[model samples]
Target: MKKLFTIFVAAAAISAAAHATTAFTDAKDAVDYRQSAFTMIRHNTGDIGEMLQGKVPFDAKRVQQRTDALAALAPLPWPAFSTPGTESGGGDAKPEIWADFKDFTAKADKFQLDAKALQTAAQSGDQAKIKAAFAAFRGNCKACHDKYKAD
Candidate 1:
């Protein structure tokens, strides 16, 4: 059952990430895709946070599954910001993303790295490492949001 669930989650994330490579019809389409991908990422990460916080029981298998899902999801949303009209596509994203495209891209790259690090930490079965990694992984959200996402 756990294996099946993990496979399902992974496949779904990959299938969704696959869309990031496709061309968007317009800025709205890109914004929609980006938002959807971020939402899914949040849901999985939130589950892991809940486990760590004791809001939910710690299930190592579930943590692994969520991290695996995150690995696949991490690359999905960043490309959408590069979609031509997304600069003007309305969402929580601010104009600064395009204004500071290099920095934004670098931060997005760091986010992917953080996601991979979280997966490694979870697999190591080290509680302290996993907690530290989880905190670091979450830092990417705030880092980007503070500068690029709207108030």
Candidate 2:
């Protein structure tokens, strides 16, 4: 069961990444792309959180799968931020994202780094390490969202 779940998670992540094309011909396409990428990121992280919180069993392989997905997905949303109307396009993104582009990119880069750490921890199969890495990754996400994403 664990192996199957791990395989499924990896397969799902690969499929999503494979299908995600950066053909942002327009603002709407960009918005959709970022939205889908973030949704996938959230889902994958939530899966790891579930295992950490014991809502699901601690399966190291599953953790690796989800974290691997997250590491890959983390960088996908930033390009969309450069698209037009990203701030006012009926999305939750705030105008500060563009106004403070340097800060935003820094935050995004931090998130990507933290996500990589989480992926490494997941691969290590140490629950304590995974928990700490997950917390750090979540903190990075929250910092960016607080500054850039609207309620």
- Pick by lDDT: which candidate is best? 1
Model 2 agreement with the true structure over 1-151: per-residue lDDT tens digits:
9999999999999988755744244666678789999999989988888888999888898889898899899999988878766565567888887888999999999999999999998888888998999999999867888888877
Off by over 4 Å in 1: 1-25
Against the unseen true structure, what C-alpha lDDT does each candidate score?
A: 0.91, 0.85
The reply for model 2, stretches above 4 Å from the true place, is 1-23
Q: For model 2, what is the C-alpha lDDT against the true structure? A: 0.85
Question: In terms of TM-score, how similar is model 2 to the real structure?
Answer: 0.82
Candidate 1 displacement at residue 144 in angstroms: 0.7
The TM-score of predicted model 1 comes to 0.83
- For TM-score, the strongest prediction is 1
Candidate 1, which ten residues in sequence have the lowest lDDT sum? 17-26
lDDT of 1 by residue, 1-151 (tens): 9999999999999988866655365688789889999999999999999999999999988999999999899999987888898878788989888888999999999999999999999999887898999999999999999998888
